[model samples]
Target: MNRRLFLAAFPAVLAAGCGFKLRRFEDIPFASLYIDAPHGGAVAQRIRSALTSSKQTRLAASAGEAEAVLVLGPEARSKVILSLSGAGRVTEYRLGLQLTYRISDKDGRTLAAAEVIELSRDITYDDTQVLAKAAEEQLLYRDMEDSAARRIMRRLQSIGPGPAS
Candidate 1:
């Protein structure tokens, strides 16, 4: 291409690049969200806490008036990996949590589904270190759930029946 044509096209390309935009949080009318999960386990608590901490949606007490319901299926699995010692005996353990989640509207229409959000961390053999590692893993799982919530929000905003800006 000639320099003149290149320069003329370059401005259009830049304009096109800068024209791309994503819907902001205010564009969605999701005032609050209801999260359904048993609270006895750490993973469940993490899931609840993640939703509550989200900037996108306020945490609601129930699904009655919520714009969305985050239903946590179950504490699917807690996988334990036994690392072998030099003599082939168990030396250390790594624990992992896998969770499935789905978001639905107040009318029970499915909005978005995430089958698995897996989080894990390794722990030493010592009891004290094990407790610390467990806490760290819990935090990691919370972070994973938070990321999943953000993804759900983006999906919902993209494909939902909510009013567009």
Candidate 2:
């Protein structure tokens, strides 16, 4: 194909390809959006890392630069069966992890209400064998937290300051 023909077809090919679009949570940084939580834990750390600009603080403090706040609620609960022996007796144990979270605006308006995000994953009775499963569970938990954070971000974006004139 000649250069002229290639160039002419390139535009069409690009157009035919999947039309990509990007969405941003907000025009302003997260630091500009204030956040408050009951506890400053791992999830809180992740939230700070993911935010555009973050100021880690407890629930009591007020965010002067922020327009919103995120308040974490009660922890969620769940159970997971570890293992079963051939004799039918419960050889292994069980474990669970709980999650609770919430988000709101600085005006005390609940932009995103509080809710629980709980998960249950298993580990075998054997010490070495259980390590892999534990790792997997950790990954799964991380993913869950990431997903929840993204959801909150999207929600905040939806409730944005309105279209820029």
Candidate 3:
């Protein structure tokens, strides 16, 4: 029992000693923000999840009620053939997601103008594994959405909470 306990604690101690820690989002100046994305927007949903994780930020009831407004444009997703077999069957494809957004004050003054973030992943597909490839594609899309949201958060952090003059 003692040996098992020490074994479990060893890695934790090493990580602590080496200063290994999880990445933490930077502090934002605003306490609340409104996400102005259309319903069923995947990128918006991901951004909302990230903001909710941070106790410092909260979603306002409406754009007018928030100190800051994040305007999210439509998200576009595409799959392009990256490679084809001699028989003209797609062997590899590049899956992509593009998201656009802007930040502004409640008064409609733009802080960060329209910015687009894109993410892509190359996947090899096999006709024999259609179901598996479909699942993989779904996972890739989810990853892209999460990545795009994180990028937007980093951009916002860099711009700070100050309004653009």
Clash pairs, model 2 backbone: 31-53, 34-66
Q: Which candidate order results from sorting by lDDT in descending order?
A: 3, 1, 2
* Residue lDDT tens for model 1, 98-124: 667777788887777555666665655
Clashes of each: 0, 2, 0
- The order by descending TM-score is 3, 2, 1
Summarize candidate 3's per-residue lDDT along 69-156 as a digit string, tens digits.
9999888999999999999999999999988899998888887899888889999999999999999999999999988888888877
Candidate 2 wrong stretches, greater than 4 Å: 1-16, 20-31, 38-40, 53-61, 74-79, 82-85, 89-97, 119-128, 161-165
Error of 3 at 139 (Å): 0.5
- Score residue 98 of candidate 3 by CA lDDT: 86
Task: Name every residue pair that clashes in candidate 3.
Answer: none
TM-score preference between candidates 1 and 3, better one: 3
TM for every model, in the order presented, reads 0.55, 0.57, 0.89
lDDT of 3: 0.87
Better model by lDDT: candidate 1 vs candidate 2:
1
lDDT of 1 at 129: 70
Error of 3 at 48 (Å): 1.3
